[model samples]
Target: MNKPKYGPPHHSASPRYTGLRTYMKLPNVNDPHELNDADIAIVGLPFDTAASYRSGARFGPAGIREISMLLRPANAFHKINPFDYCSVIDFGDLPLIPGHIHDSYDVMKEAYRQFAKHNVVPIGLGGDHSVTLGELRGLAEVYGPLSLVHFDAHGDTWDNYWGKKYTHGTPFRRAAEEQIIDPNSSIQIGLRGTVYSPDDMDAAKEMGFQILTAEEARELAPKQLSEAIRSRVGNKPVFLTFDIDFFDPAYAPGTGTPEPGGFTSVEGLSFVRHLPLVNYVGFDLVEVLPALDQSEITAQLGAAIVYEFITIMALKNRDGKT
Candidate 1:
């Protein structure tokens, strides 16, 4: 008989912690066909088999969703209420086959494909950086050769790890090789810490990705850094991928690979706020391993990051900019 409703439930009368843990307390729309009218679909990807270090990021999506219940409808900084402008829903987690990277990727790609087909922007709560490759594949089918705006503490463009090509360490390299992302238009921000060799940076450079080390980002004003990123991607259909480790360990300690030097939470938010001008096709916030986190700060930050992304979408829709 009747079709199921989509988007969030009105929770103003209910306490934030009183409902099922969904992103922004949105309604859980289990069926893909129900997502047709939604402006944004939130999906949890709980696969971390490709992690090189810690394995607990498989809980990242749930962690972020639990924390996201505290998120309000309005964004004070942007002066827009996301729900007032667009419909957003939690699509629940993709049923990933754990311990099998390729199979997981196949599943992720197909899940994202449904969102793309419906013209819904997918904000993925990640399992790890490797999950991004699958997301890129799905979006590429809808919008070919996306421009990439990558925020992370590592380049993630290593050719392989222990001869395995699908590790979290090599997702972007795979994306580049597959031509899923247009490297000339893509840029990597917040790269820092030790690498296998100096050639690590060289490899990313050779791949045509403009690299901005954490040190370099620190040197620029927030506005300047945001401007630099916006100029590079420049109106291309961009897939914005943020690894939680992009923030300093003090702010986001629950990542698989904790890099020492990274951006502050405010700085990270500034970059995301500046991105509403871009034609974003998809977004993901990855690598939040709650088992390693203290006081759930990493999960809190992860939820906030997704909040800003949705705020951007709301602002764009309100202004008729996208």
Candidate 2:
């Protein structure tokens, strides 16, 4: 008897990135019934009304999933294969309550809260940074106050939006105030752009967040930067949020806001690959606007970046606890 070789199905000619082709499974599942169980939940939020500058982040979540059709070399970076580590499945986007931002927020909170209850970690596809607030609320509900490692071009720590309190720019402000995340343990990296007033940075500092501007990241070698982040976050459970605009605009041209010089793709990937000093819990990859992009490259990059995140979660040692 011959062994089944790894490639296309011998005759069927579909190519694969991870050598697998799986799509978002459904909502409210421990794992897809097809697998009998899942270890990580991949969900789409697909709403970005909270966006201030650009309006297409509503398309980000689905666009990311559509391009994730490439997942490969799954075992290359690890001693154990990822599929053998954590079972991952797409839980379709939350049924967003249209025209109701508050209701939509509640839906996102409820959606992720269910998975957190199952001891499943989440790799969220975003509607905007606002969706992160709901996701954090869910995680905080279960994990206790979290330590965050934020990678983005803006801090997203503003106080309020046009007298409204729950926009994308204010998730961290709300999260910090609620004690849902530990301000002392959390660190924000790759910050750039001029979104807020002068007081915003002061506010972020006052809240106890450790902020590293994008310029600082460029000054350090990758290893040094990674070490600095781990040291600052220390040994606590940490959640990572990567806003795609954290990349230099030359590489990521399709985000709602583009910054001129930021972390190179290699720098960004290396920065994430070495995160330590924390229990790895949840993650979100946000702000990839497909409509502004050509050739779907931005969305494709988002998919690859999310896959990198999934691999990191899978790399966590089994004996470890979030």
Best model per lDDT: 1
lDDT of 2 at 121: 72
lDDT for position 103 in model 1 = 89
Off by over 4 Å in 2: 1-14, 17-36, 73-80, 318-322
Best by TM-score: 1
What candidate 1 gets wrong by more than 4 Å, as runs, is: 1-7
Writing each residue's lDDT as its tens digit, candidate 2 over 1-322 gives 1221111132234444333333322223433233235567777778778887786887888677666655453545445445545666666677775457778878777766677777667788877788888888878888788888898998998888799887877889999988889989888988887755777777898999998898877787766877877787777767888898898887788888788878777787777666552576788888888888767777777887787776676666343533
> Candidate 1's residue-wise lDDT over 1-322, tens digit each?
1222454666667988888898978878868778777878888999898999888899999999888888777788888767777788888999987889888889888888888899999999989899999999998998899999999999899988899999999999999999999999999989999899978988888889999999888887767877887889888999999999999999999999999878888888887776646799899999999899998899999999999888888778778785
- If scored against the real structure, what TM-score would every candidate get? 0.96, 0.86
In model 2, the Cα lDDT at residue 288 comes to: 82
